[model samples]
Target: MKRLRYIALGVMVALLAWGYVAFNHWQREMIFMPSRAVGHTPPNGSFSDQWIDAPAAGGVEGGKVHAWWLPAASPEAPALLYLHGNADTLSTNVAAIDRLRQAGFAVLAIDYRGFGASAALLPEERSAYADARAAWQRLEQLAPRAVKRLAYGHSLGGAIAVELAATTPRVDGVVVEGSFTSVVDVAKSTEFDWMPLSLVVSQRFASDEKVAALKTPKLFIHCARDEVIPLRFGDRLYEQAGEPKSRLVIPGGDHNDCPAAAAGEWRDTLRRFGGISA
Candidate 1:
């Protein structure tokens, strides 16, 4: 009877171990979805490609992050580090960068490793944060004479922007659109809510916790009719963030079209938030 009990215990332990491993892999797949297929680059030589050399957490700078440098109408204008979402690359965000540039801000849209033309490796939370830091350094180096240094992140990039603002010291402002509080919070709003996902999600971007403690000036934007990330997630983050913060509710805007839907409002908010004249 004792031998049979021991065998049963061993089998249960093995099964649990296998389940944990499998669950983590699934979470990784669900979190970081990268694509090598780039959609398009800017036309008319509007921007230039700038490759940055920065090491990811627990990973080497095998190749480098590819960035699109869109300078403002002037060299002394504010500079923005454009951290894109998991599935986005520099090619997909030309209009986004252009919008900021038109507002008199130099935008550096970066492609993290494993995404566009960057190094091909699976991106984790820490690695993405590392890439943001690298991009920040490069942005500073490239635009040393800029008056302000800001960060703008969309979707998953929003979490990365929050992380960058929390860790960096010289950041002037931060803007996050269609962002979630955390991966767990997002999962809870989905069909997988019943599963115990928080335990296995190693790439958790806990922006809720980090944003609450950050003192930087922040602007949170959410699409009221967002189909990808619920409006509640961005709302929750806005509520959780401390003082020196504001929010914009994009009425009738979806995941990717908020700026176009509210172009005047968006640019006006940027001018006010970043103290820009353009």
Candidate 2:
């Protein structure tokens, strides 16, 4: 009976380990969803394809991330590093980029590794930050003549933007739209609230903790109709942010429609924060 008991105990341990691994994998899938392919095309003479070097991460070999460069008519116009959300590719946020261009800021929007035609690596929080930094380096070279540089991120990308603003030496401003305080908090507020996500969730962006320390100017925008992350998260981030900050809650639109539905507000934001005006 003693030998049988030992075997049962070892089997239970193995099964528990397997269960944890499976749960962790599922969490990552839910968080970092890379697109299957390059699904959309830019208009002729609208934007140019720009590729930035990405160092190896998460065991994936180093490769390049694809980007769309939309330069303003003036080389000295303010620039923005467009870090898109976890589920988005550059093609998905074309309207937002167009609005930024209209506001007179050169834009560089990129697809993180494992998304679009860039690379085939698995997406993770750390890898996304690495990708953004690499893109920032490219933007520095591409827009060196610009008067200033800003970082704009939507949803999960907002968390990455906050991080970039806090860590980088060249960022002039930061804009995070419809983003959450932390991925773990958002998950807890969802149906998965029942799950112990803190233990399995390794991709916690934790923007709230970082936003408070940034001295650079920031704009936190949210939509009243946003059901994905809720307006509460944006409010919390703004409240936690230090001085030289502002918040805009668009009366209409959802998580991703503010650029279209609240076009005037977006342009105004660019003008005030980035010194760009149409």
lDDT of each: 0.85, 0.85
**How many Å off is the CA of 273 in candidate 1?**
1.5
Candidate 1 on 1-278: residue-level lDDT in tens? 99999999999999999997786666665787887768688766678888988774743344588888887777788899998877777877878778878877888899988899888877767778888998999899889988889999999999999999999989999999899999989888778889777776677899998988899999998889999998988888999999889999989779988888899998999887877775
Which stretch of 10 consecutive residues in model 1 shows the poorest summed lDDT? 54-63
Tens digit of per-residue lDDT, candidate 2, span 15-72: 9999977866676678888885666756668789998888876545788899999988
Model 1 has an lDDT value of 0.85
- Listed in order, each prediction's TM-score against the native is 0.91, 0.92
| Best model number under TM-score | 2
Residue 119 lDDT, candidate 2, scale 0-100:
85
Predicted candidate 2, C-alpha RMSD: 2.2
